[model samples]
Target: METLTNDKATLEVQLSTQQKLIANMREELGICKEHKAMAESQSESRGAHLLELKAQLEDAVLSLEAAERRMHDGELMRRRLHNTIQELKGNIRVFCRVRPMSSLEQVGADPDIQPALDFPPSDDLLSAGIILSAPSRDGAATLSKHVFAFDRVFTPEASQDAVFEEISELVQSALDGHKVCIFAYGQTGSGKTFTMLGSEEQPGMIPRSMRQIFESSQGLRQQGWELSLQASMLEIYNEEYKDLLSSKKLSGSNKSTKEGFGSQQPSGEIKKHQVVHNPDGSTTVSELTVVDITQASQVDLLLAQAMEKRSVGCTALNEQSSRSHMVFTLRLEGVNEAKGKRVSGVLNLIDLAGSERVKDSGAAGLRMKEAQAINTSLSALGDVIVALGNKQPHIPFRNSKLTYLLQPCLGGDAKTLMFVNVAPNIQFAGESLCSLRFAAKVNACEINHRKKG
Candidate 1:
């Protein structure tokens, strides 16, 4: 019995041990399953992360390719536009430059003295036109608002560089062996001089143009081009031509004689020259001084000398008024060694005498005559421009000395650009309107064919 009891105890003890072992195994199995489940979740998360990374990389690559394609398309478009502009002949383009108020004009003068020029909003792309409202008289309703449109309208705040950028293409046309003419026209004190021949610090169209031509010629040399540049300066005072570069002097004082056909007799030989027409429709003045220029600084000096010799006088309209029309001609001759081709181009830079009203100019003696001559020439220029705009069969080219001299630019295949400078002052509104109207007429004229050499 004792053995049987001990055997039972041993059996019970073994069974208890076995049951504890099974419970331990169950807990271990649960821990293994939980760890396996956790491992599978981590693997799935990593797999998804890798797929997302791959998608992002592919997207980045596609975006890069798209940007490259856009850049290529932009480059191609730019080249096409450049070629088109080069092939197309530019018409007579008119640009309006509005002069800022002078120090005198801005001083504690009456507010009414300010111009009625209405500038467009800053963000407006189509704001290149100007609205000139008639002055308010006795606080009455304004008479009219003259809206003038131009190819370009430069505000008073426009920089000299900005103005030149618009016309630099025309300068390039001359370098490409096309005749180019640029002239500034306006009333006295309307900033024609400032636009054409700005101050030393500013340096206007004439100086900038010479530098551009010089730089461009250097680049062309790489293409086997040999360039020759010649410049001549002349002024028409009272309808006569005076060589500003001539060494001959007037008989009396340092003041040169008023040169023109129907003007007062010069004390000495006025260095007279005759205008001859070539069979090819080119015109040249006999014995015109043409200086070969290698550097732009030489042009600066030449312009300075001409300005010193220009007829300027104080008038009620302008304190330092230019009393005559000045024309500076740059002749460019280019030879390409590789092509064995030669090209000659003419660039005419003109600063027209401001048209002044006799009553406003308060002229006496010689100034009165100057006013008459200037008005007459400007009137004739108007008639020629009007006739040209009207597409008249016989455009009046022999109306006045100014028009006659500009016949090639006005009537021929030359590319012409005119800068209509307008004063932004109430006192000069009428004159500005007239000047703008004349420019509008010029802009309307169309030249069918342009000679590219």
Candidate 2:
């Protein structure tokens, strides 16, 4: 019986050991199920967080698109506002500039010369009016005071930068897609050329305008605008138009072959270049050479080339006189591809031949003919301006090549600014008076309406 009891005890021990192992295995399986449940919950939370992040990303994308649209709209508004400001100032404006007398002119000069020209001391009248004193024709001792008013008047002390500051706004208008014309009008020694084409140290309007256009175009690129510029230079000499940038030579002419002024050949052969007016108010000359202006430096080279070929001669009134009206045109074409918009603008910078009398200029033969031609064209220009001012039905644009070529800029919705240069000397008092009077008339004349390009 004791042996049987011991055997039972051994079997009981083996059963208990097996039962303990089973319990341990069941407990381990329960722990695994809890871990699996936690893992599933974590996966669900992670999926929910991913969806939230996706929604936020979608919102950000939409916001970016909206901002871009608003930016585009703002740019359009800016252009409109900018143009409006320019129009309010004036569609056509005139500024008078008096050049300081050179040391040579001042040397041995008459002491009474100081009374010839005077600028008002008051700031209110300083830029608005100029007083000119000249001996009356009736009596040498009797002085006549002629007071003139204009849009703006620059004194002899005004620097090139100061002059350009007033003109920078108009230059900006050209980039905003408007036809702009800035021309200098005065006598030979009145500093018209100097004001328009200043030295390297003191750059003038053309260079400053080009540099502004280029710099502005780069800034406009951020607003989705791409601008391209084309430049053309021409000279109107002896009632005929010559391409200053032309490579052709005048056959059988005594003039330098390098100079491209198309004079009549010995065989009576004449090259005719027609000025065609486009429906878009842009003028084109047949056989005119157009250069792509990629940089401002290119325009400098062109100006140098034109100056070399330009017709200039010495006279008693002034040495190195400009015998031709040089017209430099810059065509601006802008495209906003994203907005499906396009703009075309033109800027005409003209340096007109000085206006002087034959007696004063002391011209004979060829020089006399050139002086007559210059005077005739200038007369034609004056006639056109008067007609426009009077609102005449038929403007005399076709009277001269200079007038006809500038028809688009002078009339219609184009922006025009005239710089009436003057010489601050007693000798040029009469010419200065005439110029100031003409400019005053121009400033008083108002255009009917304007439409931006």
Candidate 3:
């Protein structure tokens, strides 16, 4: 009986051990399945993200290809559009602004650009709604804004309060129906962009201008006047233009410029995209962005996009040089509060490319070619000024990429203001003179305002 009892106990212990082994296997299997599911989910998510990145890359490539086409074939398109451009001439007003002078030694070798002869110094600037500078404790930080109207021809280092406030008035004038053009022109290292569109850390004329527009619009509205606004943002890179406001997938194969003037290219570093003009006298510029905003944030959003997609390239003078021209145009179509009639106006904020000597640029191969193209375009711009000054029957506006692209603004019915930026360096004196001379000529360009018949 004792032996039988022992056998039964042994059998029971073996069965119990077998059951424990099965349970362990089941738990292990479950864990493996759960882990496998999680791994698969992660893999799928990664795959989607990769696909999105691929799409973005493809779009960028297409834009690049389109840019290449414009650089090579732009001349052809320009010839085709030449007739249409001549047929329609918009109002363009040129205001030449010379940055106040700063000493080369004190400014650590910057440039000083002179304003044109249009402004003559007078003690009674208050009549122009201008404020002259009173000495401040902060030395010469900068004109916080273009607040003063000076025929005095001060350097950029003179008065911040005067500079910004004057520019603000210029902005107000544009919104008030005078075609306005404001620009920054100077040497390669001059503060051309700084005076017009300051660094990311600092906001220059454009921001200041926008603030004034909003404020002006607000004031107008408070007086029971309403306005409709349209904004277009674009950038010219390597002679090829691109729309900074586009969220769509744009590839060279599927992209095109306005009026079929630009088609896709196979390859290139900088591409040209055509400016898309809105029907309300505002042009969206490219597939990039064309928004009509009654609010300030919308404008800021557009500016952010344009700044992001600016033509930045590696350079010796500026770590990231603006590879092309950047233009932000705002069209304000509003009712005349006093007249109770419809009015139209356009304000173009142009940041022209700084002039860089090819040899000094220190670029190689492709970069060298790019620099050459930029220099050539700028030279042609100079040629245009010379022609306009000569009052020649044929102003070679189509001589270079910059001039051709600027036909609408420079030659159009737009009030134009130019802020010639300077670096205040002795070495840049020659370039400064060149810039001042150009501003003087631009100031002389004729503005034909459309007369209501």
Most accurate candidate by lDDT: 2
TM-score of 2: 0.85
Q: Give the candidates in order of lDDT, highest first.
A: 2, 1, 3
lDDT for residue 290 in candidate 3, whole number 0-100 = 52
- Model 2 over residues 17-52: C-alpha lDDT tens digits? 999999999999999999999989998998999999
TM-score to true structure, per model: 0.73, 0.85, 0.57
Which run of 10 residues does model 2 get worst, by summed lDDT?
A: 253-262
1-453, model 3: which lDDT tens digit per residue?
999999999999999998999899999999999999999999999999999999999999999778755653663464335423322321222333345444534556333533222233455622121222222337563332224232225444444445677566556656666446666666566666766666555667777777778887876664445787766656666777667665543443333433212344443233445554456444333333456667776766677767787767776656767777777767777774643556566777778787676555677877676677777777787677556545578889766655665555554434444565544443444454556555555544444432211
Off by over 4 Å in 1: 1-90, 111-115, 121-127, 136-143, 250-271, 449-453
The model with the greatest TM-score is: 2
lDDT of 1 by residue, 17-131 (tens): 9999999999999999999999999999989999999999999999977875676466447545643463354456778899998797789558754456886544443225788
Better of 1 and 2 by TM-score: 2
**Ranking, TM-score, top scorer first:** 2, 1, 3
Each model's backbone clash number = 3, 0, 67
